[model samples]
Target: MDSVTVEGRAAAELLARKTSLAQTATDALYADMPELTTRYGAVGRERCLEDIRYTIDHLIPAIDLTQPSMFTAYVGWLDDLLRARNVSTREVIRSLELIEQAVRNELAPDEANVVASFLRAGLDSLGAVRREG
Candidate 1:
């Protein structure tokens, strides 16, 4: 087997901390938009947590392979899923931005950059979704 690349190691580290990172991102969302409670109710909070966790789960492979397209593709599917449920695109965008911040803060600088590139791609995809809306 090939030795793990730096990106691979970083991806593994991210996977190891997935739960913590997801919770942190979700907490940030709640802090930034306290009205989420009234707007989305209790299930909304759980959904946010699940979304962050799912995002991180999908992100790990993109980071490991250094493929932004993989992450962006997932973002496209996520955009559709959220839209189907009558969720605001702004919330999706905001949640992604928060996930990026949470990931960046958790990893070392170099590792963070690797992850950030994929995140930027996902964010760009989200931007296009907003524009078309």
Candidate 2:
């Protein structure tokens, strides 16, 4: 009923539709993470898709402006997940960037920004980790 609720719903729907492009995003990701593409194969592909799904299934629902820490935690988990697979934080950042590019290419400006927020958060977390390490 309120604007925030409406915006969240619209952003949620946009993220869901945009996830259908996960495979394309994965291909783009391989440009920077070629080793991962070859090494991971099907598992790598699934992880790429899961990145998109996590934004859709989890972050989008919890995109609350009041509680920003949840978004931060989600992105942290993504970084952890990639590291657990022996992938570098740089690769994870690039993967998130590719997803942002895919969303920008296919959707409206506002919708792209909505989805980009989560992607950017992931990127930021990766940067933080890079700084720490």
Candidate 3:
């Protein structure tokens, strides 16, 4: 995998923490995005897990989160996929919110800032699509 670009630390330290926090985000999604859970049904956990991983592996990096060139591409692709899946854009936003909440509750203060930054950026990217449309 390409190195994570979250500012202020070794890529290894930041990237390695992703999995530790994944389950908390996952749990929050189950509680907070019930409609999404229902929409995906039997695959809800898998789908939610996938989202958490995508946020960490793709969205968390400074390259993906900070640069509009790459970030906009992710925004477009995710919007298309959600539309095809019949998932509301708001549901995704709520899930990102919950992920941030979970990170704040579970991580050290600085680490929480780092982790929540990715979720916030994702929520912002998704909202941008709505404004453009």
- Measured by TM-score, the strongest candidate is 1
Q: Give the TM-score of candidate 3.
A: 0.72
CA lDDT of each prediction against the hidden true structure: 0.85, 0.67, 0.63
Lowest lDDT 10-mer window, candidate 1? 1-10
Winner on TM-score between 2 and 3 is 2
Task: Sort by lDDT, best first.
Answer: 1, 2, 3
lDDT for residue 53 in candidate 3, whole number 0-100? 66
lDDT of 1 by residue, 1-133 (tens): 1126768877887888999999999999999989888988999999989998999988998877778888899988987898898877788788888887897898888778877777888989888877887
Q: How many residue pairs clash in each candidate?
A: 0, 0, 0
Q: Which of 2 and 3 is the better model by lDDT?
A: 2
lDDT of 2 by residue, 1-133 (tens): 1245544654555555755667667778776667776788887678777776665455555553424456667777877877887877776677668777887887667767766876677677767877898
Between which residue pairs do clashes occur in model 1? none
Count residue pairs with overlapping backbones in model 3: 0
TM-scores, one per candidate: 0.91, 0.76, 0.72
Reference-based lDDT, residue 32, model 1: 92
Worst 10 residues of 3 by lDDT: 2-11
